[model samples]
Target: MTQTKKTAKILRCPSCGMLVQPKDEDFPFCSDRCRKIDLGKWAMGVYKISSPVLDPDVLEDLDGLRDGQSRDSDEQ
Candidate 1:
């Protein structure tokens, strides 16, 4: 006979840092309150997703746009 071990994967709630299981009603969040809190943070801009501009051509265009805007402001 062979014995097998089962491991339950646990996750922490994003809002409260409470240990939660994937089978929980909230799945990622511990409760509806915590889920709402996370949503509110997003709505209030407390959390932001940032990605680097990896394209060199796009960076050059952005720099040119800034320069043009500054020149226009200076002319006025």
Candidate 2:
């Protein structure tokens, strides 16, 4: 029988540093704790925000704000 090889295609769980097998759905995190930590990093904006064109309401609000702010800037 041919054995399946595990490779770096597998990631260790960050929290426990467990070998967290490649087949696990949450392969790299090993448990919920690591996932939550990763999520917290994102929540803290450790990464820059992308443009909000992804949200129609945000884009509309920004457009409205831009018009008002620019009108004031032009008047000055």
Candidate 3:
């Protein structure tokens, strides 16, 4: 009988779609640069949740907050 060694798990980088190993410092991403780019996209609102708002009360609260902020800015 023969035994075979297992290979490390591989994943694609979210920013550049490059293959990465689980053992890497940036496990899922290819490098530090790619990781930072992904963060930048999130900070810049390039990515957003694709689901509808199920709670009407939460939506109303968010609208109220927006209105309050605009009024405060106008007063300033």
Candidate 4:
């Protein structure tokens, strides 16, 4: 006979710091309320990307692409 153990990963709700499971309907959040709260923080600009883009060239390329796309659409 052999014995086996099961392990599951644990996560916390970003809004309330409540322990949550990946299998939960809300996954990272404990409930829809917490999920909406987290989204509201983002919508209100409370959360931000602290790190700059890794590639300066890629950023410039993206800006150029945006400008090109806008000009192409205007000409159409």
Q: Top lDDT: which candidate number?
A: 1
Q: Which 10 successive residues of model 3 have the least lDDT summed?
A: 6-15
Clashing pairs in 2: none
Give the per-residue lDDT digits (tens) of candidate 2, residues 1-76.
9999866755577666777876777766787778898788888997677764778888899999999999999999
lDDT of 4 by residue, 1-76 (tens): 9999887756788889999988889988999999999899999999998987779899999999999999999999
Residue 52 shift from truth in candidate 1, angstroms: 4.3
Model 2, total clashes: 0
Residue 51 of model 1: what lDDT? 98
Task: Give the Cα error of residue 70 in candidate 1, in Å.
Answer: 1.5
lDDT of prediction 3: 0.90
Tens digits of per-residue lDDT for model 1, 28-76: 9999999999999999999999999989999999999999999999999
Rank candidates, lDDT, best first: 1, 4, 3, 2
Clashing pairs in 4: none
Q: For model 4, how many clashes?
A: 0
Number of clashes found in candidate 3: 0
Choose 1 or 4, whichever is better by lDDT: 1
lDDT of each: 0.95, 0.79, 0.90, 0.90
Candidate 3, residues 22-76, lDDT tens digits: the string is 7889868899999999899999999998998779999999999999999999999
Query: How many angstroms is residue 24 displaced in model 1 relative to the true structure, after the best TM-score fit?
Result: 2.5
